[model samples]
Target: MSLVKKFATVASGTLMSRVLGFTREMLMAAALGTGPVADAFYAAFQFPNTFRRLFAEGAFNTAFVPLFAKEIEAGGIDGARRFSEEVFGVLFSVLIALTIVMELAMPLLVRTIIAPGFAGDPQKYGLTVALATIMFPYLMCMSLAAMMAGMLNSLRRYFAAAIAPVFLNVILIAVLGHAWYKGADGLSVGYAMAWGVMAAGVVQLAIVWIAARHAGISIGFKRPRLTPNVKRLLWLALPAAITGGITQINTLIGTAIASTQASAVSSLALADRVYQLPLGVVGIAVAIVLLPELSRALKAGNLVEAASLQNRSVEFTLFLTLPAAAALLAISEPIVRLLYERGEFAASGATSTVSAILAIFGLGLPAFVLIKAFTPGYFAREDTKTPMVFAAISVAVNIATALMLFPRMGAPGIAVASAIAGWVNALMLLAVLVRRGHWGHDAPLMRRIPRLVLSSALMGGALYGGAIWLAPWLASSAPVLSQATALALLCGAGALLYFVLAFATGGTDIAMIRRNIRRGQAAAASMEE
Candidate 1:
């Protein structure tokens, strides 16, 4: 029932999904490699997935959850339930129409938006259109699923919504594994995975819908109506749909720029998968849980509690984010090579490019997570326009940087641009929060942050040396097992070293962390009642 317990539940589910997703990407690398086929498939998938992230995770949730939470506070479950149903009906009808239209115009969508880079290659362009058409319906399914997720999160039930993403990875892994074992052709593999994407959507939607019903929130469809609350939600969601997702939108932009160069999109996609592991597990966990908690606190006029939770979320965010950033910055090459350098995946160009991209994104991991932790402060107050303005600035920065650097640095330059833009966005958000007096800069968080930075620096330095020491072994022509062992040892040693030094140097309190986890366990028991 407490914040810590809620975070644990969400974090666990997200972690599972991320692990599965990582495996899915690894398999995808072996099957498709960094080629036109891989490029086409990722572009096709990214089209629908972009909307999923933008609507489901970004704009819609920020708008929906706080309003839903307030309705519940105003008149309990009955009040929020009706509001949700109205919104759901409208959302469902709109998405259905949108899907039908988009499906009809798949060719244009592919040409203008998804992958203009493939236009010269008729085969690549045609396949991309086919794949995008097959997967476009996923947006409808996930948008509805996202609505359900927002409803569930407002009720403090996170497990189902958090775990629903795993179904997509599970389905993809199964399909890809089957295809690979059969040695299917590139188009056959892509065809199988594309259909799997749509199927996974249906499964994910069913999952959260069933969970919502089981939790006693009867959200069902009706004739679309523009009720006052639904209209308000639309008003809030419109700009959010555009501006709430600077990161995803920027990635899409970066990918679009990268697509102009053959196979560059796939390379960037692989790098994205690596950075997303930490982002999904830590950043998303904080944002998803923090938003509703902050909304509830402010709704009840508990400013002190709101401030405390915000501060703590930031503290906890940095505690994990700093080390994650370090890990990526330190071991990106070995990590990329270890996971993705096998089979058709060429270590020379693809893995090296991916490592560079990973390291670049790593430079901004802390800023990205900080944005996640801080933006909720605005969303909880229904002040999205400020974040939207800042998002626009960040997007501009990314575009300009990418344009300036892409010619010089290639695909990795887009990633570096994204990282630089992320820092700009974070600083802007924090400055605005402080200006509005919504931020809480407590001593514990302040003191721990510097220490966390120092400790992360220590880990980065150590990992750099270890990486050199193990480079020859990892790069050896020995058996896969030897490389695997060296990779594991390098990672294990780096993690162990970081934790020991961080704790010993008073960067993080082992006792406090243990107590928090224990409290989460105890509070979880009480939730069953």
Candidate 2:
């Protein structure tokens, strides 16, 4: 399949999941507001999710995909299957042990790492710990799911892995909706959501397992063995684990810094959810699909194809991310108010808090997407150490900046620190890639980047101006009409400006894009047949 088609499959599924996630958050905001219950739930969710990203998405997949691809290439199907089973057995045992440990230590983990929002409120502090304890086991299920996802991606079967997350959002929303309709207390709803998280992991794991089975990959728990294959997998996974830890440390720093603020840390998380929708849909979808493909290509000595795929992924990321960052910055307040300003959450402070964080995060969207796009180059070649070094530097910068800024700017300071860290990480990765000649300033990139930048600038200016024009309407008493008008005008203006500038300046190759669209449609049709 064409790169665009692959990206589209991943992107479409991700976009669906994100939209549902947004709906889920909206309901939570309306049902519980930014209160102790909301704070507890978000913190609880973050605990498992942080580790899920660190271990499963970041570490396991990074290590597993390349090695699995190598085995498939070298030893064919049988070898790949055996290697995967061995790795799975080890991974299963380790995750089970880790989950047991985390469950026991959940209180301490919540007290230290996830405690910022709950410091002043003893009840919230205690409840967050309890909720986190209940949810910590989610990491084990999702980690195993990630391993299954890796197996699927190695086989170039991206749909099930890409779509598994949708179940998570759907189940959470269902649970939250049920609680809200039943008019359950905030605490009750929060627990329901937490339990929903665990349940969703089960569903996700099942879907991926079935998909892997259909793809002719069998995964089972055999007697744990220290086989050479298992050792090799461990060797590759260690650097990935460290790299993932560095990345997670960046978030931990932000959480710690934001904790120092009062009454708004949870709101910052809400804003993050808004921005994460686009980042997750566009950035992560592309990364997941591209990484395994790049790894296989590099393993087969197809440097040119790998390079081309890398370039396209970068371009595609920029194309989607630039305007999204601008739009979020432009419409942060209205979007937050429109979606979240209801029931107990409909407070001026809540709107301001979410808006501030969204705007700050907007500054880093491009950098965040680039990090996803660029790091795969190293991982594709089984070189996690380079990215790990850069990640350590980025985390240090993040910590320093957050400490310095939080004293003055409060929660916004943490957001600024994260943005700075993102840029630092992206630049460092790019520099290393260039120095090693792993990535280069190809003609397409050189020609398109300036145009892409220009288009983004145009979109930003248009959105900013449009936002001002729509501010009176947005701030008016009629919430529905004002929000509708504000969102439509701002988005429409930004979209028009970006596409026009892109087409006018040759920022997009029309023929190439058209061919990709056609290819994606054909691929979908073939799958249906």
Candidate 3:
């Protein structure tokens, strides 16, 4: 499909998954509150998710997809299948070994890596270990699913892989419902949720597996071997994983520091949920499609088209991310309060604190999305190490700033540190691409970015004013309906104002968008064949 249409397709599924995830977080906030069990579970949950982000979504896909796409383009199905099977075998064995090792080292892992603070409370510490053990198996499932997703994306079949994540939220939400129905205690609920996480991974893996088969691609289990192709993949994937993994590693650092506090882990987790909506819908959709597009274009020696695709994707990234960031910066507290303040978190809630973190994330949203848009410029050309070096610098910056600020600003401090790192990472990546003569900006993109920033600023102002006007409705004792209504109106006003201002300022190019949309069918057939 056309890049825009492929983005929309992936984004639609991502939107669904993100919405479901938001619901699940709301449910979790209600069920777990800001308690010890909640803290333990979130910390433990971070373990598997960190690896999932590292191996599945981050490193593995970033490394594997471009290579896989090139193979398919150059050698066709048989060539691609042989490579995929070898990597699958190695991936499966490594994951199984990793799972077993993690299980055996559960206590030490929990004590040192996952939740050191829980060590003070035997009950909490023991439970976290148990839950992490149950969830550790999820890493194995999701890594395989991620490989399947990479294959699908390379094949231009993004819907299934994008949709697969929704089942995770669905299962977790159902588990949360069951917990409430059963009047389960905090730890009991936490345990069940952990199990639900593993179950969801299994189901996600199955769905993607079936989808891959339907797409005329299947890599069944085989005994592990170190073939030449597998060795090449490993050489590519290891560094790719590290570069892709830096963000998650930063998150791990933040969570580890947060774990030392009573309520910091839960607060950070909820804030992450709020910000991930835009990041997932906009950033991930572009990331999923951009690599293959760039890889294919560059392979055909279409340097001009490759540069254009990157520019256009970067253009869209800013277009969508600015409004999303403005809206969040404007209405974060109210949105968080409306969505999360109920059951255990009640009236006043932890919403304000989490909102602070969300706003910090807003400051960095453009940088984060731009990083995704830019990195493919490097990765598609097999230049993973440059990004990895830049990523390592970002991670060190994040860690140093996080440690310095955590003592003063708590979780919000951590968020700001990460945002700073994002800007550093993005600017450096952009500079590298420019220096290497790979990324070039067109007149339209160069002309519009400043206008986009101004439009976002205007929207932020409108949101601030609306937030003030809707103060009563957003207050603690306000009816949930009133709060929800006010938040909705506030968001609508901000979005409407952003679009009007953006267009008036010559910041947006709607005419180009329509033409791109028209080309989807032809693009789809070309990619599939």
Candidate 4:
């Protein structure tokens, strides 16, 4: 498939998942709000999820896909199947063991990691431990799911993997809604949500398993073996795991700092959920789809194509991410109020927390996207260690900044620390890439980046002005309609301003974009034929 078509397939599925995810979060906010129950739940949720990203999605995918792709290229489909089987066996063993350990250690882990949040409140602490224990095994299920997703990605079947996340949101929404109807505490909803997470992992695994079967690359477990292929995978996975762990250390730091704050640290997590919607849809989708393709291109000595693809993906990421960052920064209060100010959640608290964190996180949105775009360069080369080193530095910076800033800035300080660390990570990656000559600014990038910056600045300015002008109306009586109208107008005006500036400053290559879209459509049609 053409790159654009491949991107579209992944992007469309991701967009769908993100939309459902938004609905899920909205329901969660209404049902749970920003209370102690929500705090405990979000904290509990982050534990399994943090590790899942580290082991399954981040490290495993990076290490597994390139090797799987290589096996296919070198020895055809059968060899790749054997390789996958061996790797799966090893991965399954490790994850199962890890999950068991985590389940057993749940209380201790929560005590150490988020002690402050739980220290003053015994009930909250107990609930967090209990929920975390139930959710800990989700790491195993999702790790298996990731293995399945890697297989599908290796076969260039992007749809199933991308769509799997939607099921997760659906299940959570259903559980939360059911719990709400029963008048269960939000903590009950949280436990339900935890089980929903495990259930979603199973469904996701099944979806990708079916896709792999359809592609004639399915495998089942056999007697465990540490074959040479398995050994090689483990070796590759070690550095990848370390790299993923380092990246997540920043998040761990942020969580730790947020825990030390007041009763609503997890509400910051709720606001983060809002910003992560766009980040996950655009940044992660591009990263997952682009990585294996880049790996294959590099392995096949197609450097030019790899470079072109990287450039295009970066352009696409910046084009979308900048506008999203602007919108979040400008309209965070209204967005938060609209989505979360009902049921048990107070409008004032939600507005304050959301506005603060949104502004802080918006500062780093482009850098986050850039990190995703640039890391593929190293992963494609199977040099995960380099990124690990930089990631460690970024983590240290993140932790220190959070420690220093949190006393002064509270929950928002943690967000700022994370964002600044992202910038640090991005800069380090870019510097190394330039030094190695793996990624240098091409004429197009050199010409377009300034324009992109200018366009984003214009959009941010317009959004700020628009938000101020509409603030009174948004804060007035008839809040729902007035707030919605204000948000829509501000977003519309900002979008128009961005487009106008982009077009005038040559930030957008309209002709190229249309040509790429047409080519993608033609490719899809030919595949159907």
For this target, which candidate reaches the highest lDDT against the unseen true structure? 3
Candidate 3 Cα RMSD (Å): 1.5
Any residue pairs clashing in model 2, and if so which? Answer: none
Query: 196-271 in candidate 2: lDDT tens per residue?
Result: 8888988999999999999998866777788987787777676676565554567666765666555555777788
* CA RMSD of each candidate after superposition: 2.1, 2.7, 1.5, 2.3
lDDT, model 3, position 225: 97
lDDT of 4 by residue, 163-204 (tens): 888898888888877887898876678888888888887888
Could you estimate the TM-score for every candidate? 0.96, 0.94, 0.97, 0.94
Better of 1 and 2 by lDDT: 1
Task: Give the Å error, residue 262, model 1.
Answer: 1.0
Candidate 2: list runs displaced more than 4 Å.
Answer: 116-120, 242-248, 514-529
Task: Give the per-residue Cα lDDT of candidate 4 at 331.
Answer: 69
Regarding lDDT, does 3 or 4 come out ahead?
3
Q: Point out where model 4 deviates above 4 Å.
A: 114-116, 242-247, 515-529
Q: Which runs in model 1 stand beyond 4 Å of their true positions? A: 511-529
Q: Could you give me the TM-score of model 1 versus the true structure?
A: 0.96
What does candidate 3's lDDT look like per residue over 1-529, in tens digits? 5788889999999999999999999998888887788888888899999889877887666888988887897789778887888889999989989999999999998888887877888988898899998999999999999999999988888999999999999999999998889999877899899999999999999999999999888776778999887887787776788777776888888888888887898898888888889988999999889998888889889888788788889989999999888888888889888889998877326777888998998888888888888888888998888998998999999999999999999999999999999999999999989888897758888999999999999999889998999899988789999998888888888888999998999998678787666655565587568
